[model samples]
Target: MTNYEVRANIRVVFGDGALNELPTLLERHHPKSILLVSSGDYVDDLGIGDAVRQAADSLGATLIEDRGVVPNPRLEHVRELIETAKAHNVDFLLAAGGGSAVDTAKSVAIGLAAPEGTDVWDYFTVGHAVEQVPTLKVGVINTLPGTGSEVGRSAVLTNLATKEKFGVEANNLRPVFTIVDPAFSRTVPQHFQAAAIADEIAHLIETYTADDTDVDITDRLLEGALAGALTNAAKYADDPADDNARKQLHQISLYQHYLNFDRNSDWAGHPIEHVISGDYDLLHGEGLAIVTVAWLRFIAAHKPTKLVQLVSRLYHVDAVTFSEEQVVRGFADHLEALYGRLGLPTKLSAYGIGQEGVDIVAAKVTAGGARTVGNYYALSQEDVRALLSAAL
Candidate 1:
């Protein structure tokens, strides 16, 4: 077992009626001004706007609502919100939707606190330390659960001008509190709901593939989470309104982040997808669904041992008798079927991406004289080209 320090600082109010706790949670901060950040019409459709207004009114705080955050969480929008927050003297930021909303609010909070004349993009590009800046407190009413941004310390943003997507992490970026109400989750569009489940599965598997060490407790916990996630995903597919499954799925996403305590997790697949989504404005989860399979195939070919272990543990496959190649095929086949069950497209061609698109994205992945993206596999520029080509 490796030495690790757990920073479990976020206060979580989770359950069926968790949204009602918004006022109580915000009252603890006693802010005079609040910024309610969200994506699309969910704020209006779900009555989240009204709820936030009521909560702010109850606390005698002035509320500024920005319901314009998009799916990819653009840097341009973050800049606009940061200016809005600064102008309003906003003391608190409330994210009222999914991971995109949470991340936008986080970017604005950190951007607002950055030193004078400091471009917020520096945080993502120039290794700016978020802890160095004094950021406004953030709270989340997480209506969508996949990315786990409500409890996570990292935020992903896309720079449309540069066609660059990147993430920044610091303990300070985490929400001070998160309210996970399954009722709100039930209102999510079925497509996004399926995508969210896929995203969580990818997160768990990505972390699991980081190392093949004998950390029995962590490994078991990860396997259990993956199993539970898969089971709930099937129920979700059967009936999107399965209340118990929705609630459990949300819990699985939130809790699984804690399992990466001492592991050097691999996230190579995400950058590949980030480039695709950043350039073409594709859904993050959708791109992930396609790229994750290709990434696994890369693993199966180059580093079969860890993937073989995952199949043996999760699916009860007899790796001892079967060849590694056979185990690889089983795992790959199983994942394709699972993605099919969720109604996700498994090929890049499903999104109209082809050889030319692959060439462009491959170049972008190794841009700025960079050699690789992930730590576990250390995929080279050529490896990235090959990987995207394989997905195509």
Candidate 2:
């Protein structure tokens, strides 16, 4: 038995026109002041800011707009938003974009609720206790489908000053309500949508590849998410206007988070990609797109069983017709082909990262006296360097 705990805390409003329920969701909180967090151009282009303001007006709540959030959510910007929320006495936070915006809002909530004179970054540090930190209520209007920050308790943020990226997990930081409107995904650029699909695939594979035994039920859900994402992603690529495909992908991204409840999953790629993307200001999903294959290749050398099963089931590779090594290569090549077809990066060099950059990222992952990462294979710094070099 895994002996894991499930936290079904977030409420979701799903379907087309779900954004209209933003006011209804906020009304339950009954906040007197609200901080609307998003990118300036995104909110302006989509009129999301105005919609939030109208919602606030309907609820008699004063709205404060903080439009400085960027992709890879910066720590300095989080600090600024924390101060802004404090100055306005914001009782609620409404994030109106994708993962970056939601993460920024979550970071701000953590910062705002910290005990006086305490640094918010401390919470992200390993071994830090975060019980009973009075986090503000957060609501989300998801304009993109990947990352699933809308319903997740973890938030990833970058510290530009230190050139490091870290993730913090606290139950209180999870959004109280999330609006998943498939129509909103249509407004996102195809490039980002492709990366979002890649992110969905990575999340599913990460959980499915865990070394834990007796996770058959969790494995089925993970496999189902993989199939659903792949089928819908291809449909989306063939016809970007397919509403059903978009809706399916959006819902899969949200629902897949629950699959992690009973699994000690392999997430070696995410931390490495986090450091690389934080350093280069790359799209988080695109970084994952590059690292996922390489990480799998490394893990396959040690734990080829799950991946072999994955390719056999998902890509229809026949175990009797092919060797395990060949099947693993087929999996990697097929994934790269899928991502390339979707117009995503398949190599770190695509983003101008090279041997030197790989060396830095390897060092960063092992920084602060850490020797390894990932529960499945436990990659050493040399392992990270070799795989990343091979990726390039």
Candidate 3:
């Protein structure tokens, strides 16, 4: 816990009727045209796309709406979007769905400003110079509170050619503004909602356990953020229209992202999970929920105090009464209870990724240039294989 600085740049407009503020927000930016990106059919079903169109139209800007973003957004699609924005000479973007949509829009913002055909992958791949580039102004109307992509200066996209899911973060990735109106989540189905909750928790876990130097302020803030996310997520699971619950979930997710957790292993169950999604198209959060339990259990002894801290905060349990090992397993049990409550998958087997799939996943992670994963344990390829087997 040395001296450090974290940047919080995106202007966030929260609470109900926030989407209606879009028109006025756009008026300030005053762009000639806007590219609206959405995740899937659900956005149309929920009327989110229409809402953005209405706002963009009222603002007198041509809105080029595309609902082509996939679950794991692809690099080719990003290039296509850049071309679409270029063809229309669109100067602004509105990400109107969840992480995929927001990430795609973010990629487009960077791509359109880069030298033509610069391959968005170049920004993320090793050995390439990721120079600062011009980018479009952006706005967000987020549906899922998962990836924090709305306010984050990062975008994740998969390359089917390489069967890899990678992320790029740059100075230009943050949105100019975001309107987190959870009213849009009122009709979201259970599975997707559960996965988002899992993702939010995963972010909290990564930051909380990544380092153990007792930055008490950071620890408590991360702990509180996890508590808020779980409480509201449980409320929404019981009744989706609980606007208070939804709003709290939105607020808590933003709080979690505001911490700026590292993307490495102990910080994330993600590296292990990323390869799973990259190979099999599993949802990112679902994989995290599945892998995190195994990861936490594996590292519990290595980072006992922090694990105790996390268990105390997330489960509201007395970690002091238990031995280090008991506290560790208790955390896993508590996570299981939360997962069951949210209807999240408990094992890789649930996704039909059996023994052979586990081998493939480990091989991919090792071949993907990760000599080690996580900050605390820094598991090597062999350790990752063992972790994958444990997850299985």
Candidate 4:
């Protein structure tokens, strides 16, 4: 077995009613005032802002709301959030809602700590001089389970001007505390729920297949997460109010979030999805679902062994009876069917992407460097185009 290292530092409080303990956790961090970060829509729809305000009051911490975050959070939003934090003299950052909100908080935290002369984009796209600033710890009341942004150390930000999305990572980027309450997800519309599940499944599949690590524990955890997400996805699609299904999906999302720690996974699909979303403003999960089937087919041809193992472990199939191609292809078919069942478009054209759109997306993905990173087989621009073509 090869050597592997695992590290989990976040203080995780998981349960059906985890949000109730947010006040205590905030007090433990000793925050005098907190910037409550969220998307404007979720704040009103989910009443997350009100809940955080109440928690802050109970804990004797002043709350400042910054609620303009959107899907594929942008760099300008981070800068604005940093300014808000400074103006409010916030000692802590509280992120509420889904991945976009949590990711925005992480970027804000890093931007505030960054030196005045430095640019935040440099930290994301290119290595630049950065130092951890002394104030502003991070916490989350996660309303969505996808993206695992609450516990992960990296945040994905989009450059709206350039239509590029990239990641930024640092030890200090992880949240100080995260409150995951599955009950909050009960109100998520079935369409969003399906999209979230697609994104979560992509995370598990990419991580599980990317590296050649012999980490048995991580493998089991990844498989369990995929199985749970798959099962719950079907149940939740049929009945969004099923508390049991919602809980299971939340746990699986949380599990995938932590599993990414200390593990090297291919992030190819994310960049591709980012391009589609940035260019077309398509839903993040919907874009991911469209690309995933084609990406899996490419991976199956290039890394048959890994695909076979994943199928055997995740779907509980006997490898001896199922040929590698059949297993790999079957997994792709299953995912396509699932996406269809959940009312997500399975084809690129379904989202208004034709042959020319495919070419544009392929070129952008090539420029993003996803073609080389985390790929078991280095994929060329032609391969990407072919994948897009097949997706159509």
Candidate 5:
């Protein structure tokens, strides 16, 4: 048997009307002041703005709101929010959107907690230790699904200056509380929802393939997440408004992080996807839909056994033996078709990236004297180039 660690942190409040209970939970936390963060005007448009404000007023909690977060939040935005919160003397942060919003809040938490004279970006780029670092009480009321940032102990931010996107992971960076309500996700556009599905699928597959060692329990957990995501993906296509389906997808999104037995797993496509999306401003999931297939295809050639095992678990196939070509092509084609059914792009070209971006992305991934990503087969710059070229 191999030794490992697993996390069962984060108090989860999940349901259809979970949003209505947000105020109750906030009161229990008893923060004196709060910073409410969202990506756009949806907080007001969806009536959540008023609900949370009323909740804050009930407790006499000072509420300051900011709508500056963007998809794949930039480092500059995080710094600005941290400064704003400190200026307002906000004692708590309420992230009321999707992963980007939550991630921005987490970075805020990290920044607030960091020792004075330390920059938050140092944690990601320079390996600054966040243990016992200063942090604020944080909570979430998430909209949309995928990007396990809601529960995962990581916050990703992009430095537009360097054209690089990276994440900082520390135990305290995870949300103190996460509220998952399918109702909040009901209005997400179908295409974006599809992109979210592709993202969750990549999350599961990356962790599932991170190790080849036989860990029966972990395998079972990952398999369940992948299967549930696929079932719900189909359900979502049929009716994006289906609460039950949305709930399942949201649960699967959380499970992506929940099943992370090891804090670090082989994130096969993320570094590549991050570069592509950060450079060209493409949807993270849409880029993953393209990069993930290519990443897996390259991995399949090198480790067909693990590739087949991954596919068998994901597709619920009983085939224990699969040819190299069969496994790669079959799994790639299946995933591509699923993306197609969900209205997600099957290639980087669909997002306006081309052969030109391949070298730039490869260079970005290898910038700062670094190479190779993931545990399955840490990809070298050449390997990354080939992977992107294949996707192109």
Candidate 6:
């Protein structure tokens, strides 16, 4: 077995009523004041802002709410949040929504700690060195299940001016504490639930298929997460409040979040989906669902052994006996059916993307260097074009 190292430093509280633990956790962190960050919609709908305020009140911590973050969080939004946090003299940051909200909080925290003249793009994409100001402690109350952003050390942000989406990673970006309550995710719209599941599935596939090694622990971890996610996804789609199913999905999401701490592989679907999402403003999970099927097909064609191993492990099949091609095609077909069942569009055309859009997506994926990064099968620009065509 090849040697690997995994490290995660976040304190996690998971259960049916994990959010209720926030007050005590905040007190332990010893933050005098916290900037409560969430989407405007969730401020009232999910009552997340209120919950944070209540927690702060119990802890004698001042709570300042910012409710303007949007899905696929924008760099400008992070800039504004940085300004808000600085002006409020906020001693800590707390995110209380899905991946987007948590990601926004992370970016804002990083930006606030960056040097005065640093550009948001420089911090995210250009790898510019900035003085590490006092790191702000962050706590997350995850209301959504898909992005696994709560325990993750990376945050994806969209640059509106350049129409690009990129992510940044810093150990400090990991939340100091995370609260996972499946009940909160039950309120997510059915369609959004499906998209979230798709995102989780993509995360599994990317990590599972990226390299060839005897990393049994990582393999089992990835496969278990995939199986749990798929099983819970079906039940959640039928009945969102199915506590058993919600708990399983929540566990899978949390597992994927911690999986990011290990250096297993590169994120294949993310770069492609980022470009498509940046251009079309598509839902992140839905975009992932659309791109992943194509990516799987491409990888299977080029790396049959790896594909067979993944399929065998994920589905508990005999790798030697199962026709590799059939397994690969079956996986894609299954995902397509899941997308349709979840009321998500299965093809680019379903989203009104045409031939020109396909070419644009192809170029963007290549430019992002997604096809080359730790992929078991290196993909050329033509390969990316073919995948785009297949997705269309």
Q: Locate the minimum summed-lDDT window of 10 residues in model 6.
A: 368-377
Worst 10 residues of 4 by lDDT: 127-136
Q: For residues 1-392, what per-residue lDDT tens digits would candidate 1 score against the true structure?
A: 45788776789999866778888889999999999988777667777788889999998999998889888999999999999888999999999889999999999988999999999999999998898999889999889878888899989999999988898888888899999888888778888888877789888888887764767788788899988988888888888889999988889878988898778878888888889998888888888888888888887778778777778888888987897767877777777777888899878899899988888887788783376788678887778778878877
Show the colliding residue pairs in model 5.
113-134, 113-135, 372-379
* Model 2 Cα shift for residue 155 (angstroms): 0.5
lDDT accuracy of residue 194 in candidate 5? 85
Greater-TM-score candidate between 1 and 6:
1
Model 5 over residues 1-392: C-alpha lDDT tens digits?
Answer: 24566554677889867778877888877988899999778778777899889999989999999999888888898899889988988899999888888988988888888787989898878888875786787898888898877888888888888777887777777787888877888877787778778889998888777554556677788888888888888888877778888888888877787666643467868888888888987778988999888877787777767667767666655564757657767888878887878888767777777777888888778763376667778887778888888876
The order of the candidates by lDDT, greatest first, is 1, 2, 5, 4, 6, 3
Model 3: CA > 4 A from native: 41-47, 127-131, 212-214, 261-265, 313-321, 368-370
Model 3 lDDT, full chain set: 0.77
By the lDDT metric, which is better: model 2 or model 3?
2
lDDT, residue 112, model 3: 81
Error of 2 at 128 (Å): 3.1
In candidate 3, the residue pairs with backbone N, CA or C atoms under 3 Å apart (3 or more residues apart, or in different chains) clash, namely: 206-267, 265-374, 266-374
Per-residue alpha-carbon lDDT of candidate 2 for residues 11-66, written as tens digits (9 for 90 to 100): 89998677788888899999999998887676767767778888999999999987
lDDT of 5 at 49: 92
Specify the highest-lDDT model's number. 1
lDDT of 6 by residue, 1-392 (tens): 33545557788899866777877888888887789888767456756666777878877777788878778898888888788788888889988888998998888777877777976668778786422545588889887787888888788999878889988776778888999877777677787778888998889878776564557677778778888888788787677778888778778888886553343564667888898898888889989888888887777666667667767777777656757877787788887777777787868988888889878877776874454533556666677778878878
Question: All candidates' TM-scores?
Answer: 0.96, 0.96, 0.92, 0.92, 0.94, 0.93
lDDT of the structure predicted as candidate 1 = 0.85
- Cα miss at 203, model 6 (Å)? 0.5
Error of 3 at 205 (Å): 0.6
Each candidate's lDDT (Cα)? 0.85, 0.84, 0.77, 0.79, 0.81, 0.78
TM-score: the better of candidates 3 and 4: 3
Backbone clash pairs for candidate 4 read none
